[model samples]
Target: MKRFCKVRWIALLLLIVAGTAFLSFKNSDNRSFQLAKNIDIFSSIVKELDLLYVDTIDANKTIREGIDAMLYSLDPYTAYYPEDDQSELEQMLKNTYGGIGSIITWNTKLKRSMIGEPYEGMPAAKAGLKAGDILMAIDGQDLEGKNNQEISEMLRGQAGTSFKLTVQRPGVEKPLEFELVRRAIELPIIPYYTKLENNVGYINLSTFSGKPAREFKQAFLDLKKQGITSLVIDLRNNGGGLLDEAVDIANYFLPRGKTLVTTRGKIEQINMSYKTLREPIDLDIPLAVLVNSSTASASEILAGSLQDLDRAVIVGTRTYGKGLVQTTRSLPYGGQMKITTSKYYIPSGRCVQAIDYKHRNADGSVGRIPDSLTTVFHTAAGREVRDGGGVTPDIQVEQEKLPNILFYLVNDNLIFDYATQYCLKHETIADAQHFELTDADYADFKEMVRKADFKYDQQTEKILKSLKEMAEFEGYLKDASGEFEALEKKLQHNLDHDLDYFAKDIRNMISIEILKRYYYQKGSIIQQLKDDPDLKEALKVLGDTEKYHSLLSPKATADPAVAEK
Candidate 1:
């Protein structure tokens, strides 16, 4: 009787397993059928619209729009690229292109494209093109009424191809022309690295594209040769690129076989861990990483992994949380689709994807996961960290908001125009580090602002006006009329007073813009560093050995009192 019972139990278990498998197979088949039915319906709808619409339909554009809407409903990262847009994808991945190598901006007032800034050593700069030069024609083709994208396409072509470009200079009466050859322009991943005071080194990494690990290794070695004892890797405003490149960079500081990141998806095939494969270059060097809201994707991977391992002191504001991984699949007709395949977790086993794209609101809007909803995760040293948001800095430095006048100056292109005019008048100026706007320059700028009739809205005044309207609607305006009028008078915008009150900020903007025209991007960075609050805070943290070590320790992170101190 006992033997019979055992046999019966085994048979029942086998039957249950088979039943589960059958159910799984049936569900999979049902999903396939649903997908097929929806696709057929879509096709029929498109066919009917093409045949029955009153006006002739642009089938290609309409279908592409539909595809875009479908994809956008899923996530912002997933996108469709036709053959013509493949170059843009390639550029995003490789950061290289064959073109004249200059940023062109559309002048709304003039309704023409103009050279914004030319890369220092690229073809446009080499050919002596200046910023603010209005593009007139390209290869003998008139560019009048052509948008920036249309003109840009005309400027880019095969390497070694030559083309004629004509531009009208701001000060010059005649149109200038140049014959330029297109070359492969690869933007540098590590733009600038230098040894700082007290044996500290700084390396500014702009992107993770095109062998960033290799370039970064070389930069570190060079800095070591300069006898640096500490290092700062600035990832500020780096949107990130290839994931493997970020992994390789992490390997430079981590030990082999250490898990850097893990990706999980619907399919088991894509779920895997990325470990450090090579021996580290430096394990004991004091490291500080600078980050901001613009630091995202692979940038967050590098920063998050380091913070998780207690390998670096992250400074500045929180990072841009983007823990999603994407893979491109080739589609028909030379098109491609970049799809989000997986969500990644760092060494601490936390996903820092701020927004929950899966559960969108009724109006098709997405919101970030609130702090209260974030799950707490512990770092390697037992330090508490949280997920569902970007990586918070070990030492949070709040950025100061710029004044409204500065915003107006930038929006009106007054600062840019002033820089252009300044460049024309003064053929040479002080170097980037020492450049400063003189009192006479500020006076001239003020006069120009008055002459141009530059107008800007004061936010306070606008808010007061809104309050008045609301009060009138709610039948409270009469009672508060005197108060509103007094507030308006107090908040009235005085351009001359503002120019003098915010002179320092205006001068800084003018100086930086002018420096870029002379020294390009590197110079601007150097100049900005002279007064950077973040760098100052970083330097202070690095300078104090005990404080730096304590911030990364479990005791400091766990104990509220210690952390506050």
Candidate 2:
């Protein structure tokens, strides 16, 4: 039956190609032939399938699937926004969506869905759904068979609509049911802020959404009331949003009329300069900006401006070199195209564009600027800065890469599943600020691992197994079968060691997941801070005034030493 279906599809495809070729050559100036021919061909195929195909076809859904498949070949960022999804697309760009307001990931091992951080004040939080809750079912339908997109569509709806979910709590056998009314989940530009120490304030800015300048001003005002004298603005993994918001944020921290950035393009009319207004916030406050490779666009703008003016020390890995600016234009349908308009340059006369996208290799892959191609520009204090891709942090901090075993553990949700089990067994844990995983708990987790079906693929296993099979087939194994068997046992033992030997790393994962159930998103972050290398470095820089300023100064290019870690 499937073979027959494929044959029909192939026949239809050939017809479409032949028809397209005829229209292309037969009518050079016939817009009607171009549009009408394709439309007519598509209509005929659909009609034939509806009348002759054995299975019933949903015309609307089939058309949508076809359109989606066509667009999927392009980059993920470019998509077809169907009429039904037009409003959802707008909300995504505007940084708001209507749903339960929790990030969820499927745990295939657990045979359920694990909840991530819930946006504060949203339906999920209001209904008492905590992070680490394994979602078993939605509206009485088992979620085991549904994909992420399918579940997402089910969870989202118009505001004020209600949905019911059954969740298996970490420490409980019975699934808990909750009824939640959906609402618009609005993500603030600043989601988290607090005083790190007696005098230093920490603020995590995730996006440059509209009115972010006002939001930052308000956040600072509130922090000022708490006696914040120094500030740590974290922009790690911030992909950026509105360009105007970036300018406004820079204006808040910079001196008036200072050139923050400028944009240039092929068209002279589109080129413009962005500067800070005369009215400024407290410039005396010591500031430290944290960024990583994921920080681009507006995040880069803020970091670049601060570094250029000597206002703040930039720390962490190089920023994502996205200097291109985009503007949205409505298409004929409800769809819109967000096309690149220009490339933005920071104050040092250097465009923080790392990749030379206009120039491609023979294989059409974009190339990053070579060290020799990078141009140097001066900061406000004559500090030399370079432009090519992303903004290079003044103080470079090395990020630790996760070990392969830990990577699989996290990605496979074994860590999350065990954490859920731990939560189910314990009703109450100590306050997140003081809670620590005990040796006894670790023992129980080890036993849990023995019962799990967790599997990992390693190169040694592949090579050893392949060699053993080859030897046996070629009659060479008769001479050394015993040795081969011994080696196989040792390989399996090593595989076992990767799971048990990395107990401390595994424990950290379980601990964080458990902590989040009671303390929420902020709780996990606070608890993890004791061992966070980046946070420790931020604290050290904020504690020392001379070190902070020197790091921002371009002349201070000495490699920062790694202490212990």
Candidate 3:
């Protein structure tokens, strides 16, 4: 009877396995059929449109648009690059391009393409191009009516190629001509690294692209040489790049053969476990990683893995959770498709993907996973963490919201324009770290605004207008007429008063812009550090050894009362 029972179990197992295999085969066949059917339908529609459309349809554009729409439904990162757009893909991955190394913007008001910012030490800046210089022609080809992208394409070429550029300066009467040479402009991975007060080293990692690990290691070593006792890796605004680079970076602080992240997907063969392959440079160093909402992907991986391993104190706000991993597949005819292949789980076995793109809302919108729904995980030290959101900072420092007046000034390009004019008048200024816009300079900026006839809508005024409209519709306007009139008078936006009220903030913005004109990106960072709230908090945490160590302790995070304190 026992033998019969064992035989029966084996038979049932075999039957179940056969049934599953059959179902899988059927599903695969069905998917193939559906795919073929859709392709046929798409081809037929395109053929019909080509044959019967009233206007001449751009087949390539239409097809590309269709491809884009399909990919858009999946996720933002999953993208298709046509043959012509391969340069853009390369720039994104490699972060290197053969160009004059300047940012251009289409000045709608001026109806010209303006040099927004010329990178320092690049061909454009070396050739005396300044911010607000209007591009009239490139290589003698008229840039009139050309958009920023078109102008950019014209600027970019093979390294060592020469081009003649003509630009109208803001102060100059004649159009200045310059013969410029395009060079391989590689954006800085670690833009700035320095030893701060109390032997705390700061490394501002702008991106993870193109040998960031190697560059970051060098920066760290240099900081060590400068006698840095602790390190702060600023991953703020770093949207992330190569996965391997993130792994390599994490390896610098983790032991060999320790898992950093694991990617799981439908294709089991491609699922991977990324580990620290090298011996750590400093495993015992007090590390603080600065992250904000803009910090994502590989940035999250570095931050999350560090947090999970209890290796570093993650400061600032929550990270921009993007746990999805993308892999590029070569397409037919010199094209490429970057497809979202897998979701990655950090060391704590938590996928920090905040949005559920698969289960989108009825309105075709995606929402972040709420705090209530996030599942509790724990760090290596048994500190309670959570998944389905972002890497919550060990010490949360909320970013200060800029005043509305400042926003309007920036949006209207008033600050930028003032800085451009200031640059024209002044040949030199104090270094980025010490530069300040004087009270007299502020007065000049205000005068410029007045002369420009700047106007901006106040949110309060818009809300009041809406309230008045609602009151009228509800038959309450007659009763509240006096109150409405009073509100209107009280809420009236006074430009001069607003300007003075937000002068400090405005001056700071202006000073930073002016500094950029003189010192470039690194200078801007140096200036920003002088007044950075996050950096201040990070310094505080690093300065206090007891607090830093305690924050990483399991008991501190596990106990709610202690955590709150």
Candidate 1 regions with alpha-carbon error over 4 angstroms: 1-4, 556-565
> How many residue pairs collide in each prediction?
0, 6, 0
Cα-based TM-score, every candidate: 0.96, 0.78, 0.96
| Model 1 C-alpha lDDT per residue in residues 462-523, reported as the tens digit of each score | 88889999999999999989998888888888999999998877888888888889999877
Q: Write the per-residue lDDT of candidate 2 for residues 117-200, one digit (tens) a residue.
A: 676677898888877777778889998877777788888888888878998876667989999898877775776678877588
lDDT of 3 by residue, 1-565 (tens): 9999999999999999999999999999999999999999999999999999999899999999999999999999999998777777788789889999899876757888899888878899898898889999987899898888888998998899999999998888999999999998888788789998999999999898788999999999999999999999999999999999999999999999999999999988779999898899999889999999999999999999999999999999999889999989999999999999999999999999999999999999999999999999989999999998889999999888888888878877788889999988899988877788899999999999999888888989999999999999999999999999999998897999999988878888898888889988888899888988888989999999899989999883277887789
Question: What overall lDDT, based on C-alpha atoms, would model 3 receive against the true structure?
Answer: 0.91
Name model 2 segments beyond 4 Å from true: 1-80, 110-117, 131-144, 166-176, 266-269, 459-496, 554-565
- Would you list the rank order by TM-score, best first? 1, 3, 2
- Count residue pairs with overlapping backbones in model 2: 6
Give the distance in Å from residue 292's predicted Cα in candidate 2 to where it truly belongs: 1.0
Worst 10 residues of 2 by lDDT: 70-79
Clashing pairs in 1: none
Alpha carbon deviation, residue 306, candidate 2 (Å): 0.8
Once model 3 is optimally superposed onto the true structure by TM-score, how far is the C-alpha of residue 335 displaced, in angstroms? 0.7
